[model samples]
Target: MRAVIFRLMGVIVLMLVGAGLVGWWFGPLPAALVACAVALVVIGVDTAAQLRVLAWLKWPRHDNIPTARGVWAEMLYRAARQLRLWETRVAHEEDKLKRFIEALQASPNGVILMDASDQIDWCNDTAAAHFGLDPKRDLRQHAVHLIRNPEFFAYMGAKRFDEPLLMRRNGSYGPLLLSVQIIPYGEGEKLLLSRDVTQVERTEAMRRDFVANVSHEIKTPLTVIAGFVESLRALEFSIEERDHILGLMQEQSDRMRHLVDDLLTLAHLEGDPHQPAEERMDMRQMVERLAADARALSAGRHRIKASADAGGLRGARTELTSAFSNLVSNAVRYTPPGGEVRITWRVLHPDYGDPYAEFSVSDTGIGIAPEHIPRLTERFYRVDRGRSRESGGTGLGLAIVKHALLRHQSELRISSQPGLGSTFSVRFPLARLDLAKPGQAAGAPDAPRADRESISA
Candidate 1:
C-alpha cells in the first residue's frame, strides 16, 4: 500500500512538473488542460485494469488470469496462488470424507445421522437396509415418521440415551433383531448406531432350551430311581416283586449313566478344538465291530450286516468308532423287529471331483420327517421323547457324529422320509483315505482287497 501511494505521488509530481514546464512555454491555461488530460488517462487505465480483474474473479482460471502491468498483476498472482492452495485443501478434505463414508457403508453395523430437528441428514447403506429406508428419498424426512415404531419414538422422546433399544423387524428372509443406540452430539444432532443381533438372540434361546432339557432329562430318571428305592426300603414284598422293583431301578440307573456318558462325549468334542489325529484304521475291523455292536443292541431281533471296501481310513480311531457306532446303533434301535440294517464303506472316484471314501448306514425303520432333519444334530433333540427313552437312546448320537466327522474333515449327509427309511452317509475327504496304493485310482478294478465280511440274521 505504501509503495502504491508513493508511486501515485511520483506520478502527481511528474504531472505537475510537466505542467509547470508547459506553462512556462505556453500559457497557464494550456498547462492546466494538459495536466487534466494526463490525470484522465491515468484514471481510465486504472479503471480498465480493475474491470479486467473483476472479470477474472467472476470466472477465475489458472491459465486465463488477466495480464496486468503493475500492482494489479501482483494482486492477481497472489489471488490465484491463494485459490490454488484452498482448492488443494478442499480436495484433500473431500477425499477423507469420501473414505469415511465408505467405511461406514461397509461396516457391519448401521450408522445414521440426524439433524437438530430430528430429521434424517445422512445414513449409510447398512443403516438404510436395517430400517428399510432409501438414503436419497429419506433425506430431511422426520425419523420417527419413517420408522413408525412407538418404542423408538418413545425412546427418542424420553431424551434418555443410556441404554440401547432392541427392536424386532420383519426382514426379507425372516425376522430381524436389531440393537439400536442413540448418541447425542454436535449441537443437538444425534448419531444412531444399529447392530443385527438375530444370531446372538438365537444362540441365547438355544442355551436356555438346552439347560431346560438337561434338567428335565436328569430329573425324570432321578424321580423313578428315588421312588423305587423308597419302595424297596419301606415295603414288604415277595421275592419276584422285589426283583422286578430292583430291575426297574437298575434300568433307570443305566439310563442316567448313558445320559451322563453322552453329555461327557459331547462336552469333550466341543471343548477340543484340535482336529482328530490321522492314524490309519482298518475299515474291515471297524465295520465288523460296528456290526457286532448293532446285533448286540438289536438283541437278535433285527438283521444287521456290514461290508467294507479295500481301504483304511486315517483319523482318530476312538472318534471314528464312536461316530460309526452311533449311526449303527441308531439304525438298530429305531428299526422294528425283523428289520434290516446295512452298513457299507466304499471309495468313490468321481469324473470331475476329488476322490473320497464314503461310509453309509441304511436302515429299514421309522424314518425322520423333513422338518426334523435340519435340527437332528442338535444335542438331546428327540423326534419322539417317549420312543427315544424306550429305545435307550441318549439323543446325543447325531450331535456327536456331526462333531467327530467335522474334526476329520468329513460331512454327514442324511436322506430320510417319514416311515420309509433313513440313510446316513459320512463322506471322508481324499486326505483321510489310506488306500493300499496311495496313487491308485479309487475305481481301479485291480485294487487290492482288505477283508470283506457280512453278517446277518
Candidate 2:
C-alpha cells in the first residue's frame, strides 16, 4: 500500500514542476491549467489501479501513508502478493471442506457434530430419523437429553472416545440396535456416528441358539451310550440283560445317525441360497410316497391317511420330497398311539385369484405355543427340547422345510393350539403347477403288504 501511495505522490511532484515550466515558456495561465488537468487524470488512473491491486492482496492490516521507493517498499509489495496467494488457497480449501461435509450428511449412516460443550451443532437426515428428531427443531440441544440411553450418557460423561457403545433404544420410529462412536475433531469438536445393527444382533442370537441346540442334542445320546457302556463294564450279565443293553445301545446309535443326517441336510440347504427349480413332479405321487414313509416310520403307533387330487408341481424334486418326508415323519413321530396323521393335497381357488395347490400335513399331536410358532422355522429351534431329542429329532427339519419352500417360491404356514393339534401347510404358487404327466398314476398308490416298521426301540 505504501508503494502505491509513493508512486502517486511522485506523479504529483513531477506534474507541479512541469506545469510551472510550461507556464513560464508559454507565458499564459491556460498552459499551466492544462498541465495540472493532465497531472490530475494521471494521478487518478494510477491511484485506481493501485487500489485494485490492494483489494486482491487482502492484507490483514493496511498502511496508506506515502513513503520513498526503496528496498523496504519492494519487500512490502512482495509480501502483499504472497498474502493474496495464501488467501486464495485458503478459500479454495474451505470450498472443498464444505463439499466433503455435504457428502457426509448424505451418507446412510447417522452422523452428528457436537461442540466442546457437548451441545449438538449439526446432524444429517439419517441421524434425525434414527433418533426420531426434527432436524430444524433439535439443533443446539444436548446430546444426552436427546438419546436418553443410560449407557450412552455414561459413555459421553467419561469422555470415552476410543470405545464405541452398542445399545438398543426405542425411538418414535421403532426399536433399533445402534453402534455409537464419538470421534474428536479439530478445535475441540466431536463427530458422533451411529450405525443400525438390528440384523447383526438377530444373526448373533440365531448362532447362539444353534450352538446350544447342537450341544444338547449330542449330549442326550452320549449319556445313553455311556450308561450302556458302564452297565456292560460293571459285571458279567445274563444273555437277556446283555441283549437288552445291546438293543439300547443300537437305539442310541440310530438316533445319533438320524440326527447327523438331519444336520447334514440342513447344512446342504443353507449352503445354496438359490437352488434348482426346474424339475417338476406329480404332487399326488409325492404325497403318496411321503404318506407311505410316514406309515412305515410310525410302526402302527399312528394311522397315516393321505388324500390328494392329480396335479404336477415344478420344483427341485429331491428337495421337495425330502421336505415333505420330514413333515410327514414329524407328524408320525410326535402323535401318540391311535392318533391320526392326515395328509391332504388340493388346489385352492381364491375368490378373485388364480388356483394354487395347497399341500397340508395335519396331525393330532402335542401342539406348539403361539409365541414359539414364529421361531419354529429357525435352525435348531424346538418347542420341547427333551421330547424332540427323545424322538431322534435334530431340530433342523422345519428349517429345511422352510428353505425348500422359499426356494420354490412357495410359503409355509403353520397353525397350532396347545393339545388340540398342529397343521403345517405348504402353499405353492399357481404358476408352479401344471397338469399331471400322461400315463402317470393320478391317484394314491396301491397299499403294499405289511412289513417291519422303520423305527425300532
Could you say which candidate leads in lDDT?
1
lDDT of 1 at 120: 95
Against the hidden true structure, what lDDT does model 2 obtain?
Answer: 0.80
lDDT per residue (tens digit) for residues 159-273 in model 2: 8679888988776667999888999998888999999888899899878877887887788879999988997998899999899989988988888888888888777777876
Estimated TM-score per prediction? 0.87, 0.77
Candidate 2: residue 386 Cα off by (Å):
3.6
Residue 252's lDDT within candidate 2 is: 84
Model 2 clash number: 0
Candidate 1 has a TM-score of 0.87
Per-residue lDDT of 1-457 in model 1, one digit per residue for the tens? Answer: 8768877997799789989999999989989998998899888998999999999999888999988967788899899999999999999999999999999899999999999999999999888888999999999999999987888999999989999999988877789999999999999999999999999999999899989988998899899999888988898999999999889989989988988998999888889987756677878778888888887888889878787776778889988888999999899989989999999988888999998989999999999999999999998899998999999998889999999888888999999988888999999999998776445555556553333233232
Clashing pairs in 1: none
**lDDT of every model, 2 decimals:** 0.88, 0.80
